[model samples]
Target: MAKRGSRRAAAETQRRRQTSGRRGQERTGWRLWLRRAVLWGGALALLGALFLGLAVAFAARSLPSYGALKATQPGQTIVVRARDGTAIVELGPSPGKWLDSEQIPEVMKDAMISVEDRRYFSHPGVDPIGLARAVYVWVTGERRLQATSTITQQLARNLFLNSNRSLDRKLREGILALALEAKFSKQQILELYLNKVYFGGGAYGIDSASRKFFSHDATELSTAEAAIIAGLVKAPSRFSPTADVDAAVDRANVVLGLMREQGRISASEAAVDPSAVKLKKDVSQNSVRYFTDWALPQLEILLPETFEPIEVWTTLDVGMQQAAATAIKGNVPRGAQGALVSLDRDGAVLAMVGGTDYVATNYNRATDALRQPGSAWKLFVFLAALEAGYTPEDRVKDVPVTIDGWSPRNSGGSYAGEIDVRTAFAYSKNTVAAQLGNEVGFGTVASMARRFGITTPISTYPAMVLGSSETRVIDMTRAFAAVSAGGNSVEPYGIVKVTTTAGDVLYQHEGRNPTRLVPDYVAAGMTDLLQTAVSTGTGRAGQISRPVAGKTGTTSSNKDGWFLGFSSGITTGVWMGRDDAKAVPGLQGGTAPARAFAAYMRYAVKDRPVEEFQTDLQLPEWQLEPDDEYYYGGDPDEYYYVDESGNLVEPQRPGPGQSPQDPFPADGEQPPAYPAPRQPQYPDESGQAASDDFLDRATGARPSPAPVPAPSPRTRTLTPPPQPQQTAAPRPF
Candidate 1:
């Protein structure tokens, strides 16, 4: 009986324990369900906040409802102008939609609807049915169709949501769609969508895309063209004219099928093979890489010290920019690089190209390159000689010659024998310039170059006459420009105006903007001399129909080639070479680069009337005896020789202006002439000695004698190009 009673009690205890355990398990299950509910609620809240933020950003652009009622927003079209105030290209407002529904065609409506969202007309900005379908496919199939965002949602994404694909982000995207629906109408959303979508090719909107792809207006699209534009909406890069055409055709055909299905076009119309659409565009947008890169720095300086996204009012002309870039690229020899810059009379940057193919690299060789100017430095040589006594018509022997033990010669070894100053300058004959430098004093040449704005650290080396010193293209360009402007040197500025986006005029360039570096007559004479170059000289290829004047230079082994010229309308500069300073074999500045300059200016200044260079009003007869080289510029040493007494023994006293004589003794000694020949550049070492005879009687100016007796015909002197900047910033615009 006791055993039976114990079993019953144990059984009862076991039954009670089992029942309590089941109740505890049920409570834990309920707790888990409650925690999950809280988590999902928090996630939903976070999604809502994210969407709210996106909605606010989109609204900042404009209220959709307000935009729907208006035709267009103010200041939407940005026009790029030439330095002369001619419109080169217009930017903004593409897709046949002028920021308004009134300008949109019915076909455009269908094209956009077929491409972006078929149900856009039926819903508020968010399409719940579409999202539901997307979710169903995602869950039930291996291939997940992307989220079907409505046009409003896409705009919301474009203006606010960055490219993030997290699940939380999708949920937030959904919420933003709802907000956008309440804020904007379908029409307004469509307008914004058409105007803001990227169309690749560096184009920002439909208008730019229209000009780029078809070279036509967005309003003039055929059914085929419309289909093509519609296809690009999905991904501009994939269907752009510059991209793979087969892929673009396939995409366009898909868009056509959608158009047919939407009843926007007939099946027959859709039957037109998209594969047959001409995809190749002959037009090219010359991306002036150097100009844009240079513009960035100028924009920085033009803006306030603070950071605000302000539009930079620049002087770059789109057409001219295209022309200049095309000029450089089309003419640059293979394996070589070139850069070009166009300037207006006021020294405003008109159009600029830093490299031939801007997309290929970013080396701004135009303004940043520091190359020896080669023979272009002859301009300054003439300026110094003319100031001393030499005239353009004066005769100078172009035979082999040296100065102070260094020799210089023309590129071709053969000489014109004896040529007038004009022919010698035009031909870039080395010996004549070297002789001229010696006769006038290397100091005079160097000093004149500095005054003309040459900022490069200068030494009075005999080789400067051959452009042996380093100079940036900017200074080289400006040096030539000063000659065009009659000696008044002005700084080149890309920014014409600085203003807040609200149109507050912060800076305006006014006044003469003058820096009197070279005498007016000196500059005028130099320009006159340069005209000979463009008309029939080495720069003949640069001749525009208008009055054009310029120079061409080729460094040793064609390492550097240069063309700097001017017309009544613009002054331009171009340089070509290798980035690594490697030799560009057999290239001449006159052949390819100068032709490029002429070609560009034709299109760039088509609208402006060609103007001729003005006369030098300041100093007449600046070159003195405008006839011959005899009495006016005879060497003083021709009649006088060094005497035993150590007198200069020259006919005239040394000009107070001459270079300080080397203190070392004259016979068999070292002197301070630049570029003491490591390798002699003369054609015949013995022959150049004969040409030095004319300088013997030495009546010109001389300082005390130094080591290294009178220069042999081999030694040459150089004149640096004008410097770029020398003072505070001048107001541009």
Candidate 2:
């Protein structure tokens, strides 16, 4: 019994010791875990505090400086317009502040507040309500409405930020907003924002933007239009009329709704103008500046020292030019660009606007584009036929023909089985012109075009017959002018006479000898057909109080539209097409451009004197070249005989042993005939010397011929009595 009690006591003691040991270990582990948690928690608190302090410091230190309020200067440009005054687009004295609360149209101010900042006057640099709304969008990952922007914040972004949006950028924007407020007054900030913001295309600032977007002055804007400008501030590219039209309309509608909401405008007032107003077109380098662009490059040569600021006086009538610009802009529809070139009989460009706006783009549709003449080119084809002895009474078959794998179809899927050549030309019939081109030989036509000063490369394909060869507006107008000049190819001189700013004549465009390109009778016949085109055919829209000749073109697929015509002393061509090379929905040459040509003619010739085509008068003698079409074993004498000067009158003398009826080229080369021996490259000593500077710049070629005998002395007199004595002495001998 004693031994059992001892073992039990020992076991109990061991259990007590083990339990105490486990309790001690458990307490130690719990204490160590608490210490670790405390250390980590303290470190996190210190890091967060440091981050907060840094963010605050960064925000305070990064505030905008006064220097940033200044707009950065880029290259300045001076635009010299045709007939129109110069349009200066550049930083001028920074204009102090572009927007004056007093000067700003009330509608523009209301539009801004209604579209961009509803509570602008009541808010700080940053709008709490706007920030909260933006946060909600950020949190939900939803797209924000485009019309929500604080004016101050927008100025901050425009002045400092790139176009990308992100969390970092947003934070920076908020900081910049505060900085901008500290640097500028609310009015100053608002004004800067207005002037610095871009409104679609490349228009910068409110003043320029006003002129560019509306075609009227900023002060001329109606309430609705003012709101439209204000709406563009939220998203200039989106609300720009030219860039994103639908988005622009939608944004504009949003602004209208907001204006109504703010009680700044009545519902009726807001409804007066849709977000997208009917817009007038812009004048561009291609169109209105037609002569400017061509002359600018040469101006430097003419006025080497002071050319930087010379005012070019042009023949452009501002009102007529404006009408043409407006008509082309509105006529091309959505998919195409339009161009027009109007000239006087002297080849003075009256109205030339290349594109809708030069500010929106530099692509001059007038001077830069090269398009197939389509049926407009048919005039050249028929003219070639007329030169080849085919009369207007000649019959031409309008049948399907494949020449070198090229086939031309009559427009609108209709064909006149047999038609008079004159009627075919007047109507712009495709098949007949094509057949005529083939019959005359493409080379002959090409050579004739060259003589007419057409520099664009002409192709030999059958499409060339139907006006498929690409040509420029300037070239087209000039080539047609050759016909207007009565069968003579006149050099297209842009400058009549260049003078120094001081009025000293530097260079003059003397009336050079007109190159007789065709027989006067042949040209007269072609001119008669063209006259018919104006009165009763495709060019009827362009008819004026006087006789007219014109042609219409609708390219395959309606990709291009053209209206080209000639009056007594003027030739004009209007082209419509897309910058992207896409076809417009329903535009055709005979529609808008034809109407525009007609409208322009209404005023362009209003005050000008009346004149008739050269065809009505008697002409000089001319010789007919052998018809190229007959070279392939056909009759060579099929053509009519015309004198070398393109005169339709009979020759003074017939060739030896030939009937007076034979009117082919007089046997061989006659003196003074073209292909006449060119003057020797070098001049005789008696010729005048070129200026040393000019001589130095000239390359290996010799200088142009020197001035002939100095103008005859003013004091020189003649004696008639001396002439009789010389004849008497000769009789005595």
Best candidate, lDDT: 1
lDDT per residue, candidate 1, 1-733, as tens digits? Answer: 9999999999999999999999999998999999999999999999977877666666544544554534433223434444565544444433333435666556766877898889998886778798788888889895666677788777767665766877777666666666666666677677777776667655544555666677766666667777777788778766765556676778878888999988989988888876665654533333644665676566445555633324446778777777787888899888988888777778788887777655345567777778777777777888876655444555666665545566565564566665677787787777677777776667777877787668887667777677777777777787777778777885777767655557676655553658876666557667767888778788888877888888887777677888888887578888888888788776777878788888887887688886876643333321222221223233324355545553544455457787633323345343113322222234344333222333342423433232222211122222211111122110000
Separately for all candidates shown, the number of backbone clashes (residues 3 or more apart, or on different chains) is: 36, 16
Which residues of candidate 1, in runs, are more than 4 Å off?
Answer: 1-286, 306-309, 610-733
Measured on C-alpha atoms, candidate 2 has an lDDT of 0.62
Candidate 2 off by > 4 Å: 1-294, 307-309, 491-513, 616-733
TM-scores of all candidate predictions against the true structure = 0.52, 0.51
- Any idea what lDDT model 1 has? 0.66
> In model 2, what lDDT does residue 257 have?
85
RMSD of each: 13.1, 20.1
RMSD of 1: 13.1
